[model samples]
Target: MDTQYTALARRFRPQTFSEVVGQERIAQTLRNAILENRVAHAYLFTGARGVGKTSMARIFAKALNCPNTKDGVPCNECEICRGISAGNDVDVSEIDGASNRGIDDIRSLRANVNVRSMRSKYKVYIIDEVHMLTKEAFNALLKTLEEPPPLVKFVFCTTEPNKVPDTILSRCQRFDFGTISTDNIEIRLSQLAEAEGFTVDQEALELVARRAAGSMRDSQSLFDQLLAFGAQHITAADVHRLLGTAPDQRLIDLIEAMIDRRRDAALSQFQVALNDGVQLEAFTDQLLNYFRDLMVAACGAEGVQLLSVGRDCLPKLQEQSRRWGLENVVAALQIFADTKGRMQRVTYGRALAELALVRLSLLADMERLDDLLSQLKAGNAVVASGTARPTSAPPPRLAASTSPVPAPSLPAQKKNERLTPPPAEVASGADSPVTGSRDPAPIEAAAPPPVIAFQPGLEAELHRLMLSRLTDMTGTHLAKVVSTAISGPNRLDFSFSASYDIGRKACERPEVQARLESLVKELTGQDVRIQFRTVVTEAPEAKPQPAQPTNSRRKVVESPEDPLVQEVAKTFGIERWLRQEVLAEVVEAPAGGDLPEE
Candidate 1:
């Protein structure tokens, strides 16, 4: 007889509290509860899927019901422990809330709560996906859940605790199971591999662990899939091939090409990756992950612990991060992220990816505005490197000045003119002397900007300023004003249309009134009062309709003499009096009322 094969996830399931990986704190809490004889009536285990919520629940149940339990850990050799482990125990029941999630199911459960346990010391109920229960069902189970029998305990598991009611959450002790870290998951995978006699590469194992995304069961499942590759030795190449991702070296080469502004080389590398069966979405995902590491590396030694790449690749990654500066690295991440989004929404992923690559290549000379400003302040001319694209004209020089005279335009100035103001212009009392130069006149404080007098278009100017400063909603509210008039020397009245009731109410808010008052004071040289009024336009009177004669009524479409009615009645063997009575009923019914059917 052939033996049945079990999956790695199932074969290596955690049996004891100590065996449960990545959740030591939770396991310890449950064990302490059992040891101290202070187990609560209800427990709420919440977390992402496959993080051992169900496994923890079962372990807790076994610990509570096992006859030979020691130090809060169940001895799996006993009959009751074995039954619970196999999930067929009579005393402990595992219920899937998704299937049995109605009021009737809760009623049945409530009815059986008072009964004595079949064999174990306690009757434990483990409900998975408890958030799927209906509102009525949850309400029905509330009282029983809040105050169950002393011998009965309830353990509720959910992936989304937000969907669960706050009432239910308050009645139980909640334990949140966080995702296993990459290191912990990798260690667990190595243990499993050693037990299974598999010679897996450390890099391969790390790749699988990282690919799991902080789920132990997910990593174990992925490891099982790799075992089917029919080889005793598993390499990093196998992991990349299985995951449909480009190799680390290939991705590194592509990034280097982009950093060097070699557009053709980058495109060639991208094409090669695609041709090697690297999926577009996967390729884009790998690029995002690599660039994320680059961003961390740009943070210097403090972020070295956060890197996901192998030690062999860390030095190269740090070098690349330096070459592609932090600003450019961030820009590249945004580009790939947008490309990934487009790939998810459309089928033309290759085109979007190629466009993103070209855009990244152009960012080789990208610099932050602050850096450029610092360079200019230090009297250094900002020059583009050879890798930067050529322009028809050189960039204009920028210099700060407080003089009334404006800087000359490029056409009016010579090819190599200094950016400093001329000595003739500086000698005027209006201009300040240049930096580090001996001045003939003492430096004076710069004069304030001249304020213009109130003009006819003052309201228009205020409205423009409001539009620039306020949000779209507030600006729209202000725009709904029908007209603005000068009610007094220092007061402006804004009239709203009758239809702009909401807008008028919005403008009447205290904050909006204060903002308008400040704008008015700023525009005019004095405190100005702003008033908002609504124009109550009278609605036009509705016209009276001409009366119709009482004799004119809706005629009945069906009659006893109608051919179709007669046919239907005769076909059903209807009597003459029955047909007459039906017609009378139809005719006597109000025009708006529905007719009766036989």
Candidate 2:
């Protein structure tokens, strides 16, 4: 092609290392090697596309063969330079590795590698997309790659360095190129626009730069297209119009509305953009980029490089980042991404996108389960029943009330009754004024009754805790038998059966005591000492007394569910257990007395 009609990427191809853009480090390293007379046998160039990989390879080949060189730069005026620039030279071969990937091609190259250079001091082989070579081809080229003739040099350029085997990687001197910054690409585009006699908004150039995504050739190609479309001058609006997408301002407005939870405003903005023919998926993509900018802004100044937004966008993004935490920003991004994915399959893409918009707006109201349960007592074990696991909804609340235990020596019933509070209505009824004299009794002022410090409920607590948890502990006798507890000022004592000597000893361990004490403090907010003692059982002597009927049996009577039992039944929801009763069946009773129900 004529120079005047050639594409920008080919027209501006770098003829030397210095002419290549955004790869100063790699270029400088190769230049230094040449200046030091220390060139490697094989060179591997790896990086993203349009980031100067193949271009750098060509420059290296030119610098190696250029007769008139200064500071490792090739004189483009030389016949060797012109020949390499046009990709036609006797001593230099630029092979496309994608097409010539077979073992036969490699064998043919290997055969040609031994031949002397036709003209230049060295034969340079530039293999582009070298990773596309077949496994057999790679294996066939390995020996030649490892020990090529001193008259020959190899340059391998590939975007995917990882696809190349480590065996091959170890044989070459590798240099990785990075994506060109948007600022760098913008600068280059502006320079190109000036060279091509056109004018464009700085923002317009930035759009093209971002579209390029750090590939110089790609940026140049896009700029060439935009220039042809806009002729002499293009503004940022012109770029957005040509791209057939909503303007950046529209996206920014929609997100700001969502962040502030102005649902109506956001909806109107979205509808307007849709009516204006903006693509839903493309709008979602823009929203993703917008949220990404916000997330990076939330990360503070250190993460600024992660954003692709420009100068005018930074302040607004920073302001919006303060409206929501980084977590909310991340959640919004995820919702938008899901909406975009669902848009591909669903007919009602608009409704799905709107749902995502509403979800993002309501992210502040969302609560995690841990936060929801933070107010409840942690000691209350809410275990999931294996047979009753819920498929969708949350698991049911299963709470087992602490069962009362009988102390061997202590009046366990009355003592435990003192620990519990009485029924609200009954106590209030008892406090009601009686139908006696209205005059108050005259007496000296007296101190109030002392407050019980330790939790007597702690005993039932210890009992239920032991049954549910310690029954599985090996060598623990505390779980083998029923136990009881009593509160004495600041002390809580646990009395167990004498048969559980082993379990009692296990409870006596210091670590076990400390652990239980911590658990007690958590349960009752008390730090009282815990005493584990065995209740002794004495053998009773047989004494003669009045004889009773051998066949007569009586039904033992238990009181109705008291207010505390009712309260417990309502609170922990163990009503069925509280309602159960064990009865001694009555035989046929003598006449006159009402017979117990069968």
Candidate 3:
């Protein structure tokens, strides 16, 4: 006959209270309670699956009925201990609550509780998945729970405590078991590997531990799978292959490429991973975890440990930390966190993951404090040097050409200068016009033609002037609401869009209406009607044509001043205003104004 190799989890199942890992506090508390004879009639243990809830329950039962007990621990050699361990104890019963959760089961349990123990001082009943019990069953069992026989002890275990009724929870002493830590799981796995004569790397064990996600049963199951995959020795590469996980080296390479600003290399690495059939979401999750580790290491906390990778990777993490500032690391983490949620709804998960990676790489290019300061210093130097030098002086003015005709000095002077009579003579005698008169009609001197000021495009000019004056008076609140349009010759309409209640209110007020009317009359020298109406007039659209070249024969048009342009010029300074002035001068100046001086 050949002997078989029992799994490490079963081989090392905690037979005594002290053998349990990471649960010493729970064991000690239970032992103290038992010693003091303060044991509750019913006990409920709740936790994630497989953190030794069931095992602890069995240990407690053996401690209670051990034939020869020492310090609240069972003597495994005793017949009662052997019977309980073998699941054959006459007075101890293990019930699967999931299978027996009806009223009939409760009735059977009620009938059994009345009977005395066959071989032990107490009759112990253990029910797993107690949350699965039906409402009727719970109601039926409530009486038994409130007053069970002194010889009966009930133990209930459940993964989901919320499903259990409040009455049942209140009746039992609940013990909440926490998920095992990765360190504890790693230690356990390492010990098991050592005892089984199999070599395992630290990274491999850590991989197993993390894959377990803090569940001892899961870790043990994974350990068994890994052992089977790698017959005698387990390495990180083997673990990666078995778990379908990308290697840490590959991840480090990708991160290094991003940190180094090697966009092509990073993209190539991503393509390779995709070609290998590695899950995009999984790869992203791993990279995100790596960055998280880097952030932790950057924080300089001793407790920040990577449970999935080797300690050797810490150097790489530190090196990568130099490339990212605190803010960028935080922003990258946020992007990855958001990407994780988005990946679920997206049909093309690979593209989204790749996009996230590319975004992160670009974020890595963000300037650090020192780099930004250096750039600022360089810019300031250029500005200072360039501004210190004056622009080239306007080309030297050409000396007036010497006139060839030489006449009397006074006559030459008279020819160069215009001669005009005194103001009294000119005012009294209008017939004698001034010399060098380009316009002969000016001889009339009729009140100086009322100082005629030519305003090009009077309609547009009036509309702009009115908008500015109205905006200044009302501020932005009313300015945005009121719209002005040229209705007819020298006539402008004041209308309100649906957005402006204030505009309507102001228009209704006689004072505001009167003030606007007077201002228009003063500015345009035209009688204007300040009529208020709800109807909104459509703005006239200019016909579209091919864009005119700089020297094309198309007429140049000036745009009305908008609030945004005025506000920006006011806030930023006169530089923007000066630039606008220069543009206007360039556009309106005669064609020869910009010609090089000869």
Candidate 1 lDDT by residue in tens digits, 481-569 = 77776667778788888888888888889988888777556445557777889898778899998896554554554568777556645
Better of 2 and 3 by lDDT: 2
- On lDDT, the candidate that comes out on top is 1
Tens digits of per-residue lDDT for model 2, 418-510 = 232111111111111122212223222222221222445445545554333333352245555455556576577767678767777787789
Instruction: Tell me the tens digit of each residue's lDDT in model 3 across 1-598.
Output: 8899777677778788987777888889889888888888999989998798888888999999997888888898889998888788998898999999999999998998999999898899999999999999999999999998987999999999999999999999989989888889989899889888999998889888887877888899889889999968789888877777788788889878876767789889989987886667667778778778877867765476674356777877776776576666777778888888898897987777778778877773354333434423332111221122223322232222333222213233332233221121122222111132212222222211111111323433444444544534443434554554556655556567765656677666888777777766656445567666555556679889987668565334443265544553354454344354343453455744552222
Winner by TM-score: 2
Score candidate 1 by lDDT: 0.78
Model 3 misplacement above 4 A: 1-6, 273-282, 342-347, 364-598
What's the residue-level lDDT of 412 in candidate 3? 31
Query: What total of clashing residue pairs does each candidate reach?
Result: 0, 2, 0
Question: What residue runs in model 2 are displaced by over 4 Å at the alpha carbon?
Answer: 1-5, 302-308, 330-352, 366-598
The pairs that clash in candidate 1 are none
Model 2: lDDT equals 0.72
TM-score ranking, high to low: 2, 1, 3
- Model 1 worst lDDT window (10 residues): 421-430
Ranking by lDDT: 1, 2, 3
Q: What's the residue-level lDDT of 27 in candidate 2?
A: 91
